[model samples]
Target: MSPEMTRKIFLYGAGGHAKVILELLEVNERRCAGIYDEYGAATQLLGYPVSGNLNDDYKAADSAMIIAVGNNAVRRKLARKLSANWATVIHPSANISSRCTIGNGTVVMAGVSVNSEVRIGDHVIINTNCSVDHDCVLANYVHISPNVALAGNVQVGEGTHVGIGATIIQGIKIGKWATIGAGSVIIRDVPDYAVVVGNPGRILRMNEPEDVAGK
Candidate 1:
């Protein structure tokens, strides 16, 4: 469909990430119906009304929604609770190849470069200034933070978060829910729930139940 025909969207968060998503929607000429943030008491956000909590029924039948939360797990959980009418917002400045397949509820932010044959799954966030190389596979709810670089053939599993400025070498397979720390250089495969850090990325620890409790 033409950019002019983009549908109205409702955002599920009202913080900093939602603000960026709002700008993305604006660049594409899409309108936001409102925002839903359970913790926020503000009556409006970026000129749009702050609606009720996310669980409150969405009134507009034609409107789509996106989980604007930056946390990968929260976004994934919220997405599962909502209807299938999810919006994919791509900033006008992003360079996404026509050969790439982007799934619903994904957001491609400004200055991002997605190369040919990349497969981005549902509710993924390809954050600002990131570069995803050809043939990369990003599974559902993955968040590639700002300036992260993934070489060709890299595979990132569901709910993984590659922190800002991290670089993943070619053909590396990052397992589900892994966290690659900011500025780390990933040269090897990572297992599920592993948290890696440092210039040459090393597994710091697995994400245990206690670790999640602290967050």
Candidate 2:
């Protein structure tokens, strides 16, 4: 597909986040093929019908999909099970630099700023108003929550979840499957599967196997 043209989108989750993505599609002037909820949570979302079974749903050959759920591990897991064209959704209000490289199936929400040489991987979420400064690297399935800020050259490993209002200083390396708590200030490196919280960001506990993978 051409860079200027957008394929019809099929959303995987019909929850509150899907509501925002729906509006984002509107702003982009792209059509939604359908909405899907694996748990059958709702019959419809904002007038869009929700498919009860993803396997049985009618899909367009040219359509693309965006996993609209918020959980990092859940998105990663579901992404592995489904095979289709991936859609990268970016809000029109976002300020992404020309030098930045974003991967497929990533969703960059409104008011976000991604600076020069930043590399964001597949199925990542740079949520509302987040700022990823120069040379930051976000691995696949990472979630940088609303209002989070990452200074220059910070490296977030795969499936890491940086909670709302968190701040990570420059040159920090956050490991895979790590969770940085809300409002925390991360001054140092975070290890894999560790859950950190508080002002200076101390490790609260190591997440159980199920915590990171949702097993």
Candidate 3:
């Protein structure tokens, strides 16, 4: 469908984060079809209806979606299961290079800078004021929180959460489902399901396997 014709959006997950995303969509004058969250028993969220749970029937609508769930792995799973042409929401103020590859259902928040040759996978959140340098590969469902700085050639695996104000040095590999604490400085590789904290990041806790997958 033509860009103009593709206007309606069904947002997944109705929570605090979804509210923010909805506000962004409204600022752009985009129509919200509804929301579908497994946890949304509430009739309305952000002045929009909770249509139903996300399923094949819900997926039939022509409207695209932005998966607003905070959990990276859940977002990734939802993105993979979504119907064709999942939506990418980029705030008007986001600075993204033409050479960057942003996948479907991703959101590039306001004031974010994505430099050249960056590959951002599906349902990712590049949050406010974050600076991603050149040659970064962010896998599906990654969330780079506000004010984070990722140097060049950084590889963030699927479902990783780089906390707000965190800094990652160049050429680092952050494994899947890893959680970096806010204000942490990560200078080395992070293992899967690890929670790292402090000035120079180190593993504080290892997440249970089920927690990583939401099982």
Which ranges of candidate 2 are over 4 A from the true structure?
1-4, 55-59
Query: lDDT by residue for model 1 over 1-215, one digit each (tens)?
Result: 86424666789988899989988888887878778988777677788788665653443556788898898888877776676488888888899999999999999999999999999999999999999999999999899999999999999998899999999999999998889999999999999899999979999999873343223
Clashing pairs in 2: none
Candidate 2 residues 50-145, lDDT tens each? 987786332456688999998888998888988778899899999999999999999999999999999999999899999999999999999999
> Candidate 3 lDDT, tens digit per residue, 42-145?
77886688865665543555667788788876876776676645778888898999999998788888899999999999888999899999999999888999
Number of the top TM-score candidate: 2
Candidate 2: C-alpha RMSD after superposition:
1.7
Model 2 compared with the native: what TM-score? 0.94
Residue 71's lDDT in candidate 1: 85
Q: Which ten residues in a row have the lowest lDDT in candidate 1?
A: 206-215
C-alpha lDDT of residue 125 in model 2: 88
Sort all candidates by TM-score, best to worst.
2, 1, 3
lDDT of 1 at 17: 93
TM-score of each: 0.92, 0.94, 0.90
- Indicate the residue-level lDDT of 141 in model 1: 88
lDDT of 3 at 37: 78
Q: What overall lDDT goes with each candidate model?
A: 0.87, 0.91, 0.85
